[model samples]
Structures are given as structure tokens and as C-alpha cells.
Target: MKTNIKILALFLICSISAFAQSSKDAETVLQLSKDKWQWMADKNVDKLKDLFDAKAKFVHMSGTWKTDEELEIIKTGSIWYKEAKVHDSAIEVSGKTAIVWNRITLIAMVRGNEAKTEFTVTEVYQKQKKDWKMLALTFSSVRDTHQIKK
Candidate 1:
């Protein structure tokens, strides 16, 4: 009976440790996603370039594009991200991959015109080496009241 109790206690400790690590990873990814929005608004392509994976894909209402094209769009002011007001966000971390969902109201300048839209943005990140790199970003139009299920 004592041996069984010890085994159970050890198992609980290991499970708690794993859960704590996953929670930490989720928070890290969430912060990264928030920083990415600010970088986009500032048109800081240098920081974005490092965060985006080499083959990263971005999906927008207008069209879909790859990392280089997306960077070029931001750099050239084709689609200037003015601000992203994040209403809600949720992050899930599993092993080396993390997925974040954010409901945001984005104000942007598109082709010389200012536009505001509500969207749910899904971002996927993968741990590469010691850093996390964004692999995919997709924006879906949604109602202002849309909520991310926790």
C-alpha cells in the first residue's frame, strides 16, 4: 500500500510539472502573437522576418500569400496595419506547436483607403531551435460579438 501511494504521488508530480510547462509555453506564444500585431502596425518587417518561418503563409480576405510577399506588402504600405484591438484570445500548446486564436477589430490602410474590420485571426507557431516561428496566419471575418471558446 505504501509503494502504491508513492507511485501515485510521483505520477501526480510529473503530471503537474508537464501541465505547468505547457501553460508557460502557451503564455509565451500568446505574447508573441500580441507583439506581432504591434510589429505589423509599425511596419517593422525586420522583427517580423525573424519571427515568420521561411515558408510561412498568410491568408487574408483579399488573397493568400507567402512570407516574402506578405513582408513586401507591409514594407510597401500596400496594406498598412494601423491598429488591432484584440477583444479576446486563447492559446493551446502541444509539444513543439502552439496555436493561438484572437478576436480583433483591425483598422488598416488598404490601397490608399482606410478600412476597419472585425476578424478572428488564427496563428500557428512551431518551436524551431530555441525560438518560436510563425507558420501560418489566417484572418476570418466575424461579427463583433463573436467569442473564442475557452
Candidate 2:
């Protein structure tokens, strides 16, 4: 009976260690979501592309999710963002995958008109080759725009 108890205790310790490792990996993947906002704020599309998987699908505020090819086209339009921030409201880490739900606040200019918008954004990332790559992203507008006097 003593030997059996020892084996059981060893098994429990191994299981808990595995769980902890998985949780850490998941949290690391989720951090990539925040890096995306910094990339956009910098208006360097190249950085965004580096983080994105080649097969990434990005859904715009227009209600249409574009494939990688389409997203690349949009990136070419010259993004000029004045302000962008991501508030990490919740983060859940699972093994080999992570889902980040956050609020994205941004001020941008389209045709020289300041556009301020908030969105509830969810981003999924995968671990590949020791790096986290954004696999998918979807967002919907949360709050409407209010004019800022110049």
C-alpha cells in the first residue's frame, strides 16, 4: 500500500507540472496580441505582417473578413494612426493555443477627418517554430464616434 501511495503522489506532481507549463506557454502567446496594437500605432505594416501567419484572416470593421491576400492589399493603403491602445480585459490560456479578448481604442484619420472608435477584439494565436503567430482576428465596433474639436 505504501508503494502504491508513492506512485500516485508522483503522478499527481507530474500532472500539475504539465498544467503549469501549458499555462505559461498560453500566456506568452496572448502577449503577442498586445504587440499587434503597438505595431499598428507605429503604422508599420511590416511589423504587423511579421506577427501574422501567412494564412491569417483579418475581419475589418466593415463586417467582412478578408483573406491574407486581401489584408495585404489593405495594408498597402498607408496606415496613419494617431493613437491606438488595447485594454486586456480577459486572457485565458490553453495548451498550444490562446484566445485574447480585449478592447481596442484608436484614433485615426481618414481623409483628414479624425475617427475615434472602440472595438471588442478577439485574437487567436498559435505557437510555431518557437514564435507566436496570429492566426485569426475578428472585431466589432463597441462605441460610436464623437467629434473632437480642433
Candidate 3:
């Protein structure tokens, strides 16, 4: 009976430790996603390049493109991401992949014109060699009142 109790206690401790680690990973990915928005607004392609996977894809209302094209657009100010005011966000982490959904008011300069729009942005990130790389980003136009279900 005592041995059984010891085994149960050990199992619970291990389970709790795993949960804590998962929570920490989720928070880290969440912060990375938020930083990405700021990097886009600042046009910090250096940081973005490191964060984006080589085969990363981006989907915008205007069109869809790959990593190099997206970086070029940002570098040339073709579509300057001025600001993203995130209203709500949720993240799910499964194994090495994390998906984040953010509802935001994005102010951008597109083709020399300023536009503000509400969108739900979905970002997918994968852990590779101790670093998280953004694999995909998709923007969907939505109403201001749209909420991200937790």
C-alpha cells in the first residue's frame, strides 16, 4: 500500500511539471507573436527574417505570397504595417507547433495610401532547433465587435 501511494505521488508530480513546462512554452510563443507585430510596424526585417521560416507563407486581403516576397514588400514600404492594436488574442500549443489568433485593428500604408481595418490574424509557428520560426500568417477581415473565443 505504501509503495502504491509513493508511485501515485511521483506520477502526480511529473504530470504537474509537464503542465508547467507547457504553460511556459505557451507564454513564450505568445510574447513572440506580439513582438512580431511590433517588428512589422517598425519594418525591422532583420529580426523578422530570423523569425520567419524559409518556406513561410503570408496571406493578405490583396494576395498571398512567400517569405522573400513578403520581406521585399516590407523593405520597399509597399505595404508598411504602421500599427496593430490587438484587442484579443489566444494561443494553442501542441508539441512543437503553436497557433495564435489575434483580433486587431491594423493601420497600414498600402500603395502609398493609409488604411485602417479590423482583422483576425492567425499565426502559426514551429519550434526548430531551439528556436521558433513563423510558418504561416493569414489575415481575415472581421467586424470590430468580433471576439476571439478563448
Candidate 4:
């Protein structure tokens, strides 16, 4: 009975440690998301290449594409992010995967046309070795509060 109690206690300790680690990872991933936005605004394709998983999928209001394609677009100055003002965000971590929801106001240029819009972006990240790589990103356009009918 003593041995069984020790084993159970060990298991509980391990579980708690994992939860703490996951919380830390979530915070790191959240900060990485913010850094990614800064990179996008700066058009830093090289840095983006390191952050994004090779198999990453990027979905936007305009279109969807793989990591390589998105890099190409950014490299060619096709879609330029001028600013990303995050209003709120939330993060959830599950083992090796982390999901972040960010509500933001974006100022950008698409095909040389300036656009200012609000979006709720869902970003998925996966732990790889010692680093986290972005696996998927999806954006949904949000209506402005002023635009809602009272």
C-alpha cells in the first residue's frame, strides 16, 4: 500500500510539472506570434522561413497557400503588412500543440491596394525539438463595433 501511494504521488508530480511546462510553452508561443507579426510587417522572409514549419498552411481573407508560397508572396512585395494592432488574444496548449486566437486591426497592402481591417486570427504552433514552429494560420474578418446595428 505504501508503494502504491508513492507511485501515485510520483505520477501526480509529473503531471503537475508537465502542466507547468505547457503553460510556459504557451507564453513563449504567444510572444512568438507577436514577433511573427513584427516580422511580417518588416517583410523579413528569412526569419519567417525559420519560424514557419515547412508544411505550414496559411489562410487569409484573400486566399490560402503553403509556407513556400506565402514566403514567395512576401518576398515579391505582393502582400505587405504595415501594422498589426492586437486588441486581445488567448492561448491554449495541448501536449505538443498550441493554438492562439488573436483579435487585431491590420493595416496592409494587397496587390498594391491599401487595406485596413479587423481580423480574428487562429494560429497553430507545434513544438519541434527545442523550438516551436508555426503549423497553420487562419484569419477571419471581423466587423467593426461601429458597424453593428444597435
Candidate 5:
């Protein structure tokens, strides 16, 4: 009975430690997301590419899906960010796979025009070998003017 109890205690400890590590990793990725936005604002396309998985997919709110190269164009100075703020976010992990949900507001320069937008973004990250890479992202945007007044 004592041996069984010890084994159970060890299992619990290992489980808790894993949960803590996963949360920490998720937080790091979340912060990375913010940093990636900053990189985009600066038009650092090379760095942006590093942030994505080689097989990454990005889905725009308008139902347009893009490859990593296509997404990098935005980071290459095609658009500029006047304001971008991450609102709410959550993470779920299973083994090497992590799914992150992030809510954000963005004011950007697009096609020589300025626009403010809100979005709910879901990103899937995979642990590739020794590093985490963003594999897929899907987001739906809400026009700022259409949002309810608080």
C-alpha cells in the first residue's frame, strides 16, 4: 500500500510539473506573438518568417487563406501598424501541439488607408524537434464601427 501511494504521489508531481511547463511555454509563445507584431510593424519579414513554421497557414477574416510567404508580405512594409494590442488569450496543449486563442485590436495602414479592427485569432503551434513553430492561424475580424459601444 505504501509503495502504491508513493507511486501515485510521484505521478501527481510529474503531472503538475508538466502542466506548469506547458503554461510557461504558452506564455512565452504569447509574448512572442506580440513581438512578432512589432516585427511586422517594422517590416522585418525575415524575422517574421522565422516565427512561422515552414508549413504554416494563415487565414484572413475575409476567408482568404495564405501561405507563410504570402503572410510575410505584410511584414515587408506593405502595411504599417499604428496600434496593435492583444486583449485576451488562452492556451490548450496536448503533447507537442498547442492551440492559442488571442483577441486583439489593430489600427493599421493598408493600401494607403488607416483602419481599426478587432479580431479573435486562433493559432496552432507545434514543437518541431527542439523549437516551437506556428503552424496555422485563423482569425475573424470585427469592424471597429460595428462593435457595440461600451
Candidate 6:
């Protein structure tokens, strides 16, 4: 019937719209990941605290820490990020979960020692009540590909 055909067409349109919306959301999450790095570099613990989930876990070359502990470290400048240069990044979203990957060159002060290193960072964020909060983060050291040729 023509009515049945019309209903099917409308359903297809709605499905496509939903898919586009999800794609847009994924892009937003990727940008948020970049913003997070900027926040860390600036040592904006207040903003970082708002973005991190209460049950979040952070892992680095040194060790792992919970959300509150990580926030405290940032606030006190124990391991302060001075700069982060992102070399490459990607993001994927599945329902309310998003995973972001970034290859970055980071300069930071770790326990009063200035160190610069390259790392591949993975961040997992979950959508919580219309906002995305970071749930977990892990980083692995990488070779510096950003070195200038003399």
C-alpha cells in the first residue's frame, strides 16, 4: 500500500538522522579530549575535576591513581603538564561510551624534575546525564617522532 511505503520512507529518514546525530556527538567528544589536554597543561584542576568521573582511574608510567588522588596531584603541581603537542588523534563512540586515542609530545614537571616525553594516550569517557565524564585514562611512552632534523 502507498501508506505502508510512506511509513517505511519516514522510518528510514529518522534512522539516518539518528546516525548523523551520533556521528556529530563523536566529533564533539574528540574535541573535548583535546580540550582536556589543554586543561591539564594549564593545571586547571577545578575544570578537570568537573570533567572526571568520581570512579575514574588514571594510569601513567609511574603508577595508577583514582580520580580524587589525580585531582589532588594536579592541584598541587606534583606532576604538572607544561605543554602537550598532539601528533595524531582518533575517537569512536558506541552508545553512551566513547574511546579517544592521542599520540602526543608532553613536557611536564614530575616531582620537581622537568621531563619531556612522547606518549600514546587512551581515554575512555562515558555519557552521564547529557554530559561526558572521563572514566579512565592510560598512557604508554613512545619514541619522539616530532624531533627536528639538524
Per TM-score, the best of the predicted structures is 1
**Model 3 residue 79 lDDT score:** 97
Query: Which residue ranges in model 4 land beyond 4 Å of their true spot?
Result: 145-150
lDDT of 1: 0.97
Better of 1 and 2 by TM-score: 1
Off by over 4 Å in 2: 63-79, 143-150
- Count clashing residue pairs per candidate: 0, 0, 0, 0, 0, 0
Compose the digit string of candidate 2's lDDT tens values, residues 49-79.
7787888787766545544553444465333
TM-score of 2: 0.76
Which pairs of residues have clashing backbones in candidate 4?
A: none
Pick by TM-score: 3 or 6, better one: 3
Which candidate's lDDT is highest?
1
Evaluate model 1: give its TM-score. 0.96
Q: Pairs clashing in candidate 1?
A: none
lDDT by residue for model 5 (1-150), tens: 999999999999999999898888877777777787687677777776777887788876445445555465575545576666877677777888888777779778876888788987778888888778888877677653433221
The runs of at least 3 residues in candidate 3 whose Cα sits more than 4 Å from the true structure, single-residue gaps closed, are none
Query: Who is ahead in lDDT, 2 or 6?
Result: 6
Output candidate 3 Cα RMSD: 1.1
lDDT, model 2, position 130: 84
Off by over 4 Å in 6: 1-4, 145-150
- Estimate, for each residue in 8-115, the C-alpha lDDT of model 6 and write its tens digit: 999999999989978987888888888998899888988898899999999999899999999999888999988888888878788899988888888999999999
lDDT (Cα, 0-100) at 13 in candidate 2: 100
User: In candidate 2, what residue range of length 10 has the lowest lDDT sum?
Assistant: 141-150
TM-score of predicted structure 4: 0.90
Candidate 6, number of clashes: 0
- The lDDT ranking, best first, is 1, 3, 4, 6, 5, 2
Per-residue C-alpha lDDT of model 1 across residues 113-149, encoded as one tens digit per residue: 9999999999999999889999999999999999999
Better by TM-score, candidate 4 or 1:
1
- Relative to the true structure, candidate 5 reaches a TM of 0.83
